[model samples]
Target: ASFSHSQYEATISWPQIVAALANNLYLGPQLGIDEDSGYPIFNADPGRLFTPLTRAEYDSIAQRTVYHPQSQSDTLAFTFSNLDLFQLPAGAAGFAGVVEYGYQSYDLKPDPLATQYYYYSWKDSDGSGSRNRWAAAGELRMPLLDSLSLSVAGRYDDYRFAGNSADKFTYSAGIEWRPLESLLVRSSYGTAFRAPDLHYVYSGVGNDETGGTDYYRCRTEEPDEDLTDCSYSDEGLIRTRSGNRALGPETSTSWTAGFVFSPRENFDVSIDYFNIDMRNQVQDLSTDRLLQLEANCRIGSDVNGNPVDVSSPSCIDAIARINRLANGNLYGITVNPVNVARERTSGVDLSAHYRLATGIGDFRFSGNYTWTREHLFQQYTGDADVDEFQVNSGFDIPRNKASASVSWEKNAWTVTLHGDRLGRLPNSDSYDQIVDTEAGEEAWIGATYRYNLSTEYRFNERMRLSFAVTNLFDKMPPKDPSYPSSPYYDGSWFDSMGRSYYVQLTTRFGGGPL
Candidate 1:
């Protein structure tokens, strides 16, 4: 048995410029006359802009003071194991078990000065928030036959926040079989759950960027315009989003089956298939979905022939729009996270390795590839699922990826060459429409490939030096005009930093007991 305890704390302070940017201090009210009406525009209505302030007035309201935010966490854990309690007469024990328990508490406190300057809905009485969670887990493994094995595991977790508590359980089972001397097969099925993180569950108030069109504004431009057709005229919106305490854990079930083949020495290969179906996937409704729901409520019926009540809590919560301009131009909309979506993804993975001995050195080669067959998502329980395979809808998940490496070692020197590839991705229908309207044609991104080389030499038994050149060709990412902010390419899927070189040295001197 073993036990442990730990405590941690951290503090963060922001500069004057950071605070000014966060608060949008550079944007003042408009003071000019309207061109269409030839009328003086002033801060006279809720949606009207305020008069532009002088430099002195702007400085007085900017609040250039520093902000010091702090957070702390405490953790305690206990573990027990009895894998050696039983032994077989042949000296080959085939049974094992283990158990563990842990608890953690977290607290966050914001700077008083920051609270006065920022616009947030936090109302903690003492300017602090806290939450605690505890979990217990156990696992067992046993051999069912001379060439077969089985394993099972389970875990339970309880979380407490402000006087409320919630509990969840997850479990999994797996099996392995060696039917032949050179072949092995394995399969596993598991269920998992994830509680909302502190920021997702207790973040008082914050702002986020959302992509969608303003229905009211769009209708004014074209009387018979459809909501789906309005995306061409929309860029995006900034809005408020808050955490929800009533959220529960997101759950998922996954299964995998694979086989390994080793036909000869120094050579092997493996292939695996995986599938995951998740329910109650925690996510905030996108601006487009929110607007669609609001439109459904206004029509008194949903697409599935279900009745809709405009005054219901769900409807009211889903619709939040602001018109900052007196002429009724939408500035933004609000959204919050909820456990309301479903996602299903399936894929296959392949890997292989081979080794050979040469006159000068020993060479080894390995490669791996993954092909995603399907990636589907449903916004709500009763909504239809949308396929996102091979499309880049801002999720950053590509349909195909592959990598290969070759290495050679001789005496005290080792060298290796590696290559990586990312398959092409298609744009979503709405995004495609927006691009076609702006550029007069359809757009698509092509595949990308990168290479790297590394070398290492050992000076002695205790000293070593290594060097590496990443992105050997200094290849640049492909351009996509659809994304204005990052028109170069998808930074998440491709390297935007270009080529980079690195060198490392290591030395070890300690050999005696401490």
Candidate 2:
């Protein structure tokens, strides 16, 4: 049996810039217009037409710019294992069981100024909520034959939160066969359930400033401009988010089959294929996707000016989430978490390892590769499936990813080298529409690879020193101006840091002495 507790707290603050205050209803009139341009002129100088805030007032409001949010969790679990039910020629049948209980809670408290929108910050919602969960599981392994084994497990989970409750049962079964001393085969099928996370289910309404091209706004304001080559920059757009208490658990079914081949000692190769289908995936729509949906609903067209179904449920939700100003300008967007129809993916994984010992040192080489066969996603029941590999489909995941490493160990020193690679990806999903435009040059960012090197020295049984360098060759992410976002690269897939180095010394001492 075990018990554990965890807690997290954060105090966040945002700058109350003069420009933001100038846009406030109470101050916009006081700050007069520019005499020459006839537009609102922002000036800090007191004698100018614009009236600026006093230093004292600025200081007073700065003190009220902080908000605090905190979360805590307590968990307890009990388990019983190593109970042999019977004996077989190969081994004894083993069984195990476990039970777990947990409680989690969170509180989001915004500052008075923020709650009242006294500054640039939006009026954030405030609330506190909690949940309780219980789980039980059992597993059994049986060696029915000398060359084969089978195992099965089952689990049940129940969750209660915010006047709502959900329960799920999951199960898995597997089999393994060793037909020859050098080869082994295995296969498994399983089902899983994931309850809504504490923060995802209980977080209060909040707003953030994000950037995305408002397609509807762009087309409405610039009817004569060519949108294909348009680099319409839209920044500091508001995105509001809030949690949902009625969310159900996400569930998945998965299966895998694999085999391991070991013709000799210290060397092995393994290959596996796996597929998973999930339902009721809980997630929040990204800013770009949300805006695109809104445009499709309002303008009845896609980015390429193609007609789309505007009467669908997805379109209805999209239109409702977007708020507009008096002049039909975009005011903000709401992106609450909701359950999507389904997501499915299948892939194959290959791994190989070899070890060699020589008079001077021991060397180990290993490599792994993954090939994604398919990835399908549907946001709603009638929505079309989105293929991840298709260009301009909004999912830019490459089909292949791989890593390889080599390590050598000598008397007291160990050195290692490793490399990671990702297959080519289309520069942007909107590349086709802009192919004839000026921003379109490279259609794809070729396969990218990065390397790392590390060395370690052991001074004694208890002391060691190590040094490492990442991106050993100082590789840079390929430039793609056609991509919509700034920095011209996928920040999610690449790091802007050119090269990094680190060194460390570690020592271990007994409780009695150093």
Candidate 3:
């Protein structure tokens, strides 16, 4: 039996904001007029305007600035194993089994003064805010035959928050067969579950200033007007995202089968086919969907203009009146995260590795490639499934990706070269409203390739040095006009930081605490 415990804490600071406010530099309200061109400030561009604020105005804003925020987490675990207690028949008597239990707690504490700044979206707590969860797992391995082995595992988790609890059970099984001295085949099937993260489950209420057409107002303006162009303007909509205590866990099932071949002593290759089907996927009710629902309700029709019941669960859930103007106009709508979607994806992964020795050095090469055949999603159980394969739609998952690396080592010196490729992704179809709005175009995202190089040297056994250059050729990411505010590139899958170099040194010493 074994046991362990750990604790961690971090402090976050916004030095730039503090410095700007202290120096009375362009951190306050915009000027009423341009000082240089003598023009009325229709839209004061902060980048071009360096106007300073009055002493009182600067102090007022500075008082609300948050200099520091803190986050902390704690974990404890215990494990037991009895595999060495028994022996099996044949040469495969190395059976093993293990069981473990663990608990973790996370807390986020923001400065009280920061909560006064509405623009910061700063979260506030009356006390020590924390989230906790517990997990237990067990695994067993056994050799069923001279050339065959089997394993099974299971896990259970419980998320506890205040007076609410969410739990789930997941399991998996696997088998391996060695039909030949140089070949091996393996397969596994598994089930998994995920609870929504704290940010999605426990965010504070805040207004998000955004630009989009309001479908409800548009429908009422011109009965036959195109929904896309009506009331299309930047609006400060009151948005609230809070923890859903009743939220359930997202569940999924996955299976994979593959074979490994080593026809040569120093060369090997493997290929695997994998498929994953997920249900009860946790996601926020998109604002676009909410607007669409409101439009349908006003028109007494569905997305297809078919007459439908307005009081249905889908419609009622989307139609929320969170805020209203003094004139009794609807001011804001509520959108919350819920378990409502399903996803299914299938793909194949191929990899190869080879090693050889020469007089000057030893060389090693490795490569891996993945091809996504299908990526389908259904918003709700009653909705039709849409294939997003090869399309940068909802999640922007690419259809294909690959990487290769070569390394040479001689004496105490080593060098390596690596390359990565991301296949081109097609824009979502016009019918896919979510993607159309987010990406802004129905064109393909150009393919991108990047390279990296690194070198390492060792001085004796206790010290070593390394240097690396990422994006060695300074390759830029493909342009996406839709993301002009975000450096014109998708940071999720592409490198936004151009060429960069890094150097590091490592040392180890054998001694007592000193």
Candidate 4:
């Protein structure tokens, strides 16, 4: 029923500097070398660093690259609904069945330069592949009594790609009970599956970089200097990553129980509890953690000077994946994705909405909040569970989060305000060295909030104008001195942009009243 095609192209250019040659020419005079009589220099050779006399000479060293990639997909689907399965005491049992087929292909071509390394340029590898998929699903719903109903569904999916294939079957069931007109209860259990991402399985070798203070090296080489004052932060070491075609599909089982309360037609609230158990989760070591593990492998201690077992599998793997210079400086690292043991989490969700009509205008209020009770993970079957819900757990996910909004509407105008609260989290992912000196306690970034406001006006049945402001108060991200990386804040959760504004005008050519 649908088909899509996409194409992308990019051109990149950069300057490649010969650091040694430049340094030698600039420092010639300091080293007592006078290759050029009147030229300024400060310690090395001039013949080895002569400037290019023509554009052609300079072009030979300048790096340039072109990359193009394309992809296409097609799908056809059919569904049959409202078919009667059987008769029940209160209603007729209805069934629905669906069938679908899809095919997709992508050509991910990297530039020729991507295979070669430059003094300051990154490297990348090819990722080109295609896949086809087929799926079938069915659902049945039955009403046994006037106030209770039940539903069940099942699905099967098969995928084929690059000399490999995977197939899975999943199912779900749910029950609902409405003892009163204003109250309802529901519960559900389900099993789910996900195929490996195309890029995760098809991407070849790639290289990138990250920068931070090499704490282990600094501590060993400059034992007299305070760690906070160490001046080792510089250009990042090289890191290489690659994909794996042997990755298996991820599977999970989830259960949920919830209830809805509606005391009046204009007000409602719902609360739900959910738990999930996942297996064969695919992942790779984060840059921060990788660096931390590298440090641990060499020093056998955390930032706090606590002892660590350097002979463990994690440390052994870390040592094997990294290469070091003769002076013990980091040279390169290899990080490949792999399937891990398990991840289990449980949480509660609460939401409510209310609407009121008054002489001034119609007002609506809505709010939602989530609380994570527990989060546990294991890297291997026999490994100990790592608790991830506590403070300073080295995970970005917060234990609590909430949002609220209010809106007002009149004859031709509407206005709304919204706010979000990002819960507290550790400033650094490492296990130690975060403290408030005066208070003698660990320091953390407390809850932060942002707000937005918008207003809209309708000029006619088909035209409207709108304006909005995000981060209305221009709140800045919290600063943490203990963070190891540059721009010492969690960029993943917060935006550095202080404030933003926008305006828009919309018009409809053929539609109902606005």
Worst 10-residue lDDT window, candidate 1 = 119-128
Write down the RMSD of all candidates, one decimal each. Answer: 7.2, 5.7, 7.0, 6.4
lDDT of each: 0.67, 0.80, 0.67, 0.77
Maximum-TM-score candidate: 2
TM, every model: 0.69, 0.79, 0.73, 0.77
Q: On a 0 to 1 TM-score scale, where does candidate 4 land against the true structure?
A: 0.77
- In model 4, which residue pairs have backbone atoms overlapping below 3 Å? 26-42, 27-42, 27-43, 27-44, 28-42, 28-43, 28-44
Count of clashing residue pairs in every prediction: 0, 1, 1, 7
Residues 213-255 of candidate 4 have per-residue lDDT tens digits of: 5656766777566545666544367888888888888889999
Q: Which stretches of candidate 1 lie over 4 Å from their true place?
A: 1-131, 208-232, 288-328, 358-362, 390-396, 407-419, 428-443, 449-478, 484-514
Superposed Cα deviation of residue 138, candidate 3 (Å): 3.2
Q: Cα deviation in Å at residue 403, candidate 2?
A: 2.1
lDDT of 3 by residue, 1-514 (tens): 5566666666665522343344344434545777896755544356735666676756554543343333455556666666654455633333334444445445555555544343343334322335677778888777777788888888888877656677888999999999997999999999998876666566555444333335556556654644333443223455555555566778999999999999999999999999999998888766544665566665777434567457655655556533546753456766667886788999999999999999989999999999999989776666546566523223466789999999999999999999999987643222223344456445567678899999999887878899999999998878774442435566567666779999999887864321
**Which residue pairs in model 3 clash with each other?**
201-243
Tens digit of per-residue lDDT, candidate 1, span 1-514: 5566666666654433334332334343447789999975544353323556677755554434333344555556666666654554423333333344445454455555443434322212112346777778877776667788778888887777656676788899999899997899999999998877666677666554445555444544663654346543465666666777787778899999999999998999999999999988888656655654565555666543457677765566655443245755556676677886789999999999999999999999999999999988865655545566423232435689999999999999999999999886643333323333467234456677899999999998888899999999999877775554434466556657778999999888876321
The lDDT, on a scale of 0 to 1, for candidate 2 is: 0.80
lDDT computed for candidate 4: 0.77
lDDT of 2 by residue, 244-337 (tens): 8878889999999999999999999999999999999998776677777787678887666767789877888888888877767677888877
The true-versus-predicted C-alpha distance at residue 367 of model 4, in Å, is 0.8
3 or 4: which has the higher lDDT? 4
